[model samples]
Target chain A: MSKVKIESEKCKGCYLCIEVCPKKCLEVSKEFNKKGYHPVEFVNDKECTGCGFCYQICPEVCIEVYK
Target chain B: MNKILSRPESLTLIQHSYCPGCGHGIIHRIIAECIDELGVREKTIGIAPVGCAVFAYDYFNFDVTEAAHGRPPAVATGIKRVLPDRVVFTYQGDGDLAAIGTNETVHAANRSENITVIFVNNAVYGMTGGQMAPTTIEKQKTATTPFGRDIKRDGYPLKVCELLAATGGAVYLERVAVNNIKNIMKTRKAIKKAFQNQIDNKGFSLVEVLSQCPVNWGMTPKESVKWMDDVFVKHFPLGVYKDI
Candidate 1:
């Protein structure tokens, strides 16, 4: 299975990763960070391909993917 | 498995003040990665410009100096000349580099100063609220050109790479974008090469990044990326404009 880690504090909540993810395993959290933006969460690690597309598309460089 | 992605050590830990999805953060990371990978962080001296990236000094982990508006190239030239052993570079935006600093840029390139320039061409005066910039495409709507830029009045977009290529002082000049996975990777490689050229004592080198300004462009981040690829790319035409 693949896993994704997010540094919530670094996330700007642009959500570009969710839009580009092929697996749809990520979702925006209801909680807000210090910046008051909803950080994204990995909802289903089992569905992740670890393709690193999310890692590539993140402008803030806040996401990590592990296979 | 190992850590796949993390903030580069060359970048400070402070959260960026850039708007969400701004390209400045990505570009900053790329520059930091290049410096780290090249093991030149300690020797790198970055000159921050007077635009959205004015706060670059706060984000970079190494020594950083702020230059006057549209004067990074000139400032970088002075620093690099004095400290030839250090890795000197300038981080500038479209408004600062191509508009007000046009003369500085051309003359610096003409002098073949051994400095790396990372020019972010987002097509608007971002810090000043989306005013028309020299890099703004003709017919693009900006605060100063609300009805779309007229070619006759505004002139055409300034092709920095092409302009610098003609000066012969620029030994390496490439334009890259950061909208997709492949392009982002290419941008990283391009940045590294530009810095490497400076390290090798080559003449002036510049990497013009065709970035997206979502807030200024009045579009979503995705739409801004799309427009950059579809419309902006057509005008700029990415590739190595000059290489030696």
Candidate 2:
């Protein structure tokens, strides 16, 4: 299974990845960073197909998928 | 491989939306080639601004995000912050960066955000029907400045590199043109440096390319290059403004 990691400090809360994920494995975490923004989180890594759609759509380049 | 030419896998085969002989095509090819050479096509993320090159998303093989007018910097900043491991850059035009999004560009650089900005300055606005742009030279005629751009009224042309370099956040800044083979080579080098700066985690690199918009400039493609060499270069001298 592929895994996705988010560098919490860099998340701008664009949430573009959340909108494009076909697996719906990502969401904005309730936790806020130093920038006072809710970063993205992988809700279900097992559901991730790793199609890289979320990676492609993310403007912040925050998501990395390891297959 | 010739870095100046386009790679089949890196670029879409469709005809570009830019005007005949417009520099955007050349700029696009150079950028795509760089991405291909770096083997970052899959890992690179590009932000396209709203301008003549708005369809830039269609040209590159890598993943792309369409940013609101003048917002590519902010979008790229967000992306770079989140995905520091990935290479992120923005392709913007004068009207998008220097005019409406000037604040965003300035602050992004001021913050030394780890992102690359490819700023295309063609003087007049290309997509919006040739209005006077922030980089349009004084006494130049455009749709909005039919009589000629009066410096006193419209203000002076914005020298982006000079302005951005003054900020401590910027790590690399260069101004190059594509009017000739020599300058085109220089532009490619500058662009490569800008991207490498980001890869090295250098903050806020920008390459202001003096491009041509023949249709908007009301000149033939050939004449536009001549105009750029004769006129535009006079106002925007070509050279590196900063590198660290």
Which number leads on DockQ? 1
Q: What TM-score against the true chain A does chain A of each candidate get?
A: 0.96, 0.92
Once fitted onto the true fold, the runs of candidate 2 whose alpha carbons sit more than 4 angstroms away are A1-67, B1-8
lDDT of 2 by residue, B65-129 (tens): 99888999999989998999999999999999999999999999999999999999999899989
Docking class of 2: incorrect
Give per-candidate clash totals: 0, 6
The segments of candidate 1 whose C-alpha lies over 4 angstroms from its true place after superposition are none
lDDT per residue for candidate 1 within B1-244, as digits (tens), equals 7776677899888777898888888899899999999999999999999999999999999999999999998889889988899999999999899988999999999999999999999999999999999988988999999999999998988899998899969899999998877888999999999999999998899999988889999998888888988999999999999999
lDDT of each: 0.90, 0.82
Considering every candidate listed, which one attains the maximal lDDT? 1
Worst 10 residues of 1 chain B by lDDT: B1-10
